[model samples]
Target chain A: MKSDSDILTTIAVQFAIMSFLALGGANAVAPEIHRLTVEVHGWLTDRQFADMFAIAQAAPGPNVMIVTLIGFHVAGMWGAVVATLAMCGPTAVLALYLARTWDRFKDAQWRVAVQGGLVPISVGLIGASAIVLARAASHNWSAVAITAITAAFAYWTRWNPLWLICAAAVAGLAGLV
Target chain B: MPEPVSPPAPAAPIPSHAELFFAFFKITLSGFGGTLPWTRRMFVEEKRWMTDNEFNNVYALCQFLPGPNIVNLTTVFGSRMRGPTGAMAAWAGFLLLPFCMMIAVGLLYERYGDVDVARRLLSGIAPAAAGLIVATVAKMATPMFARFGPAPFVIVGTAFAIGVMRWPLLWVLAALVPVSIALTWWRRR
Candidate 1:
């Protein structure tokens, strides 16, 4: 079993890595996170990772819940605390420091370039995350169908996704997923 | 017809650090899964702490950095409102409650994850998650499309290239950034 210190160190290191690469959102680091959790740390399997991601989504808060879950897996309750704090702390500090000088360069050209440069990269990262999740979760034809249909509905319609989620839940209860 | 002239008024005073902390604390607790748009509504439109342009600019910067986007955003907004202290308060308030909830859920899951009912419940929730991701993509895309003709199209093309064509993400980004910058610059000129 992993020791408490080791777990805390892992959590801190993971968050530090995530803090740096989480460009765009939590999704941006999802692929890397998966690699670490499943491949490197041996903390969880790919399916378990996907399941935790689903839990994070179903929960009514930020996507950072995955950190909590992974932490719990590694070292129980305290691990959860360490992981969440470690994940959020650095970014908060960075944002604070950057905010101090943000106003002075509001109209700078590099700012515009940075903004322009990041949008596509963020989109690309999010898209990559989708592919990774789909690969992990799409174990059966039904799961694949659900993924494709959800993507289609979202892309084409304005229907609130809550209904689809409920429908999927019902289907899963009926052994559809 | 005589033009109506408005009387000159004093500018609003900057909010105090305490007030900024409380306001962000509320935003952090209240905001749920789809935080970006709601954050825009609160900070840019309702509170008027920052202009839409400012929010967009800051959001762009936050995106390139690490961690949860909203957490980064809260820090930036809080720091702007006060200083590092305000930023810490905001981060604490925003994170503390959610972290508690997630831990509780995690504990419960650890205990019962292998139970049949729990398995069924989790399976049921998976599709809902897929739907949520779709919704998020739509919500994020709509605003990007609303501004600058062809920008939306470019975003869509980029999404398709990345999503369906399996294009290398970096290469796609490499191609699109300059194209978007050139188009925006040319249009502005």
Candidate 2:
């Protein structure tokens, strides 16, 4: 019984830490979230993690909803509320304070340098997220083909990504990759 | 891009807390796929609450902060209009409906997640999700590498450490962010 409360507190703390480290956004922290929830805590499976991300992206609102879904999976309604707030609250407050004072440092050299340095780090973190998700999603050659083709279309074309998701679903239904 | 040395016009009329809240509420409801572009349209084109340049400036600040860029934008925009209360209203408006929807989806997934057909459908969706992330990274990476030097090194090193070696992310960032920042600072100097 006590373990249940401990788990909830842990979920809150974990996501709160993730909120600040999400330099490029929640997407940049996906790999870490996957590691903690799936690997360390045994909260969900790789399949479940992948599905939550897919559902979040396919949904009408923010992609950050994935965290909320994962929280729900872990600890019911309270978990959902705690995770959503933990993931967003600190960063929102920080942005509010920083936005007000940003103009004062707009022309500072150090500020520009920090932005320059952080950009690549952010991209790298996000790249790691992509790699982690790819490894989880594709285990067979046929699945690999789907990932490659979809990625090519996404990179080279301006087609809406939702179409690709739908097409993949149809392929799955048809017993094709 | 020089402007005449003239006093800036009076600040734009501030939105009421209700207006701030409902505007975000509407934005969240209509935001399919992504919210950033929709937010720009509402703030700049439709409402004229902020000019394009103003929107970009705020967006840049949000990007610099750690969090979902759009969520940060909501907080910044709301506070600009009405202070802390405004921030709460806007944040609630943006997240409340979507949070409920996600909960519903979570419930549905729990019930049907293991069904064979549902499993097949999710299997299809997962790879596509991976593809989308790859595309997003590819697009973001090009600009970082357009004038390459330390940027590629940081990107490759970080990626290799996390993705290949499976190192804990906290330690990797703790070690690398300082190095990357110092490199940029030195180069600029």
Candidate 3:
């Protein structure tokens, strides 16, 4: 059996790498994270991962809460703390440093070029995350329909998304999906 | 006739570190579905910590940085207001309560997650969550892709490689970023 420190170390290393690679945010890295924790490490089942993600979304605050849930599942409290810090620490430092200097370079040609290039990549990563989550969540036609309809509502309407989540829960409890 | 001059606006006070901490803590609590809107509301309208234009500029930079955009924003804003210590306060305030809450959730899941009712609820929620991600992508696409550019190509190519072919993300990005940047630079010239 692996030691507790080993598990924490693994969580730290993997999540730290993911911190930088998470180009579009936490959701963008969802597919890779699922691959690592669920498929590669066998720390969680696909259902468990999906459930955790749903729980994270249902909770208040930021989207990165899923990483905390995953870390907690994989290695308890320390795992959660380490994974969260690793995932957030490097980027926070970068932001701190950049906040000091970014504005000075705001109009620079290369800076503009970088921002222009990264936007599409970020969108693409988020799209990949949607595909990954849909694969895991939509096990049936009804579930697929729920996903599609919700996506439509979110795209075209200004209604609060929490209402859609609540409606879905009712549908599930009523055995519709 | 000359228009009357408007009265000077009140000078907003710089928030103390404690105030920064509590402000972010409260913001996290109120942010149910997403926190970005709340962030803007609190900083711009409620506290007047930043004007609309300043918030947008800072938000743009945060988006460009790696990791979660909101988390980066918290750091950037706090650092601007009160240096590193304030940054720590804001970050801690934003994260601590949520961390505790998630741990509670993890415990609850461990105890009762597999019960039929809970499973059913989760099953319902999962698809909705996935749909939110799709919606986010669509929301991001409209403003930029509406105009003619290399964005559509990069967005589609990146999605196909990662989502469909299941290629490694690192290699795909390594190949794409340089090409995308070069193309953008060339187009601009």
Candidate 4:
């Protein structure tokens, strides 16, 4: 395969910036990642993005691993490594430093405002991501039903989502969906 | 803030860097759905390393800070235990397994993803995955909506602009975050 250093650079730069934007965690930035990979660069199809998401969610670790999958698709294994490190590395450094003085100003009025302010926005961002993903995934009735049922379970019951994904997979294998 | 009173006395010996690594590594393996419960079990209950209150405080702090919440928890807990190296040790251990496994998953998907069985399975899983995200949003939004404040507006505006309008996230955030903050600050200040 011919090498494309540009793809790796793009992966690193975009994800590194989005690191801070991941306010409510990886899910919060999902829409942005979806935009960049699907809309901007056309690295992955909408179905591929949704499928990679399910794969990452089913696998252990952070929700951000979806970045790794995106990188894998774009630039192969190196893309995967660079994307994961770029997304994770800088933020890890920030956490290390903040762990020290954050406790000192725990009740600082400014800190409280900042935290409170970021919450609704991040929640909204995640909401946007859900919309984008649902649009991508729900093309047919079986898929639509699975999405609704899973959302119900997630919101109402505290059942582990792994089981929900499993049931859906079984349904697909049976060609039910 | 009353300086948080005195720090609680240590319950057990401080974890070494190796101990920190293994602890997180263990959590990763057992972290099927999510790691918070296992992390809490290991740090607070099993290891008796940090008290329940300490774990809660750390977790809240991690969430408030940027980055993946649990990943932040690993960094904060590791740094608190030993120092920078401890942080690195734990971070590495926490990520190592998942990184390898995800790579493997990616490779397999690339090689055989187009095969009928895999496509069918993924198509089934994809919608359910989308539902999971919807559920997550609902869970996050419910409390903000219940409060009957500027928060609901912010959440809705954000969702609308990005989700429906397909605006750029950076610009959307730049336009909204500060206004949201100013509203909150002005109200609370």
Q: Pick the candidate with the highest lDDT.
A: 3
TM-score of every candidate relative to the true structure: 0.78, 0.94, 0.96, 0.95
* 1 versus 2: better lDDT goes to: 2
Per-residue error for B100 in candidate 3, Å, reads 0.8
Q: What are the per-residue Cα lDDT tens digits for candidate 4 across B1-189?
A: 223442365578999999999999999999988888999889887788887778778877777567777788898888888888888898988998888889899999999999999999998898888899999889988878988678999999999998999998889989999988888888796
Query: Model 4, residue A76: what's the lDDT?
Result: 85
Best by TM-score: 3
Query: Model 1, A72-164: lDDT tens per residue?
Result: 888887888788878888877877667667658878876665566457556656655676676677777888788778777766776665566
Mark the 10 consecutive residues where model 3 chain A has the least summed lDDT.
A23-32
lDDT per residue, candidate 2, B1-189, as tens digits? 343233233245778888888888898888875788889888777777777777778987787578887898999998877899999999998998899999998999999988888878878878888888998999989877788579999998888888777787889989999999989999988
| Superposed Cα RMSD, model 3 | 3.3
lDDT of 4 at B134: 97
Candidate 4 lDDT for residue A1: 45
* Clash totals in order: 1, 0, 0, 0
iRMSD of all candidate structures? 3.9, 1.2, 1.0, 1.1
DockQ of 2: 0.76
What local lDDT does model 3 show for residue B17? 98
Quote the positional error of residue B176 for candidate 1 in Å: 13
Give the runs in model 2 whose Cα sits over 4 Å from its true position.
B1-12
Higher-DockQ candidate among 3 and 4? 4
DockQ of 1: 0.39
Tens-digit per-residue lDDT, B20-107, candidate 1: 6666666646655455666777666566777656676677667666568888888887776667776776677667677777888887
Clashing pairs in 3: none
